[model samples]
Target: MPTGPKHQRFVFVEHNEEGQACGYEEDCRCMIGEDHDADASDESLNVNDAADIWLSKGMDEDYMFGFSEAQLRRAAGLS
Candidate 1:
């Protein structure tokens, strides 16, 4: 079983008053909840073979949730 402190994958999009997407965010955190481990690594996210948060807030979700043909097929269980 995985033994590292638990982390939750996240994705959020902020909307403005005009109903347009204004910000996007994604990351892995050591469960920022009522309970947490002090030793948990804040840099739990890995990108490009390195421990890092792939994208910070303020970007659009499209880049992270792109609809490539391969991804679509995988999502539809066609692969």
Candidate 2:
């Protein structure tokens, strides 16, 4: 029942022109510089079920999943 490498998850907040969150301040708190809450019931899910979740400010379509480093490199066109 080995799960292999563990993937890290992050949450990105959308800010307004003045660098303020649009809405849901309580639910959508900042994830940076803080340890992820393990007891938290609600959590964000990665796009397309990607192993390594990356919260970005803008649109990103490069997220992918692979079982190994070589597979990830190949998927990202780094091979």
Candidate 3:
């Protein structure tokens, strides 16, 4: 069967001390949720990479959730 839209699989981005997106979350939550891994690497996210990921997931640029480009950049540590 064909999977629905990619946006339906929205992955949560874990933030670090500086409020930067570090890595992806498999089940919404981090260490407390299922599929949690304490040894997971906290890689920093880039603004361009984040934007591409959102676009690839079928999210409309103009109608994106409450998050703005600035926010994405800041959260990705690109700012």
Candidate 4:
């Protein structure tokens, strides 16, 4: 099991009043009702609300893998 601070992944977007897309962000922290101070814009939303919004985007597939426990130790010169 993973033991650490729980984190929810989400995406944010900024759009104009004409219902046209302007910009978007992947992996936004304001998914679970978090603060929007980091990205003070006219609009903000979650990643799951694709159908609800005029335009929405998805995050890219992260092909990079995380380091193993042993690999971490070796890199720290503890092995």
Candidate 5:
């Protein structure tokens, strides 16, 4: 798992203009060059079982891709 504040936060997105999230760094680079709106959050975190649950609920369904809590848990193999 990532250590410290710098590595703790992570960005998760379902898709960008190109479709399904490829990577954050590349997306940020392309978008920044175009001067398009880009967002970041201190809320992103390195994955752990509990964090996975929180992430599912936190994803923005209307503005971004997000998985339901149950879906995240199942994907994490949590029974």
Candidate 6:
């Protein structure tokens, strides 16, 4: 968990050696160069869960993401 000011925390995004999104981090919730276990999923945070987290981060009530809550949760493998 990050412990800085609301907008000062660094959001880490895993990128490939080419500096592009690895494209697999979202699925396995694993960092770059790490082996993904087929049955080792522990990151099952759903949309409501995400909303709570975002709220904790000072997100406004009307704030939205590039994707809908369902879509975001689905991408997080919680659908």
Please give the clash total of every predicted structure, in order. Answer: 0, 0, 0, 0, 0, 0
Best by lDDT: 3
* Best-performing candidate as measured by TM-score: 3
Q: What lDDT does the true structure give each of the candidates?
A: 0.36, 0.36, 0.50, 0.35, 0.40, 0.41
- Which portions of model 2 show Cα errors greater than 4 Å? 1-66
Q: What ranges in model 5 sit over 4 Å off?
A: 1-37, 46-65, 68-71
Q: Which tens-of-lDDT digit does each residue in 1-76 have in candidate 2?
A: 3332334445444433332323332332334324456665574432222323322312234443223344333333
Candidate 3: regions farther than 4 A off? 1-40, 60-79
Instruction: Give the per-residue Cα lDDT of candidate 4 at 74.
Output: 41
Q: Which ten-residue region of model 3 has the weakest summed lDDT?
A: 1-10
**What's model 6's lDDT at 74?**
48
TM-score of 6: 0.26
Report lDDT (Cα) of residue 22, candidate 5.
Answer: 34
Q: Which residue runs does candidate 4 get wrong by more than 4 Å?
A: 1-65
Minimal lDDT window, size 10, model 1: 45-54
After superposition, the stretches of candidate 1 with alpha carbons farther than 4 Å from their true spots are 1-66
TM-score of 1: 0.19
* Residue 30, model 1, lDDT: 41
What lDDT score is found at residue 51 in candidate 6? 51
Which pairs in model 2 have colliding backbones?
A: none
Kindly list the per-residue Cα lDDT of model 3 for residues 1-79, writing each as its tens digit: 4433222123555444454545443424232434344456677454455656666666567533435666555644557
User: Residue by residue across 1-79, what tens digits does model 5's lDDT show?
Assistant: 3322222223544333222343353323331344332464646423343335465667434422254444444445664
Per-residue lDDT for 1-79 in model 1, tens only? 3344445543434333332334444444443542344566665322221111112323334433423334333433455
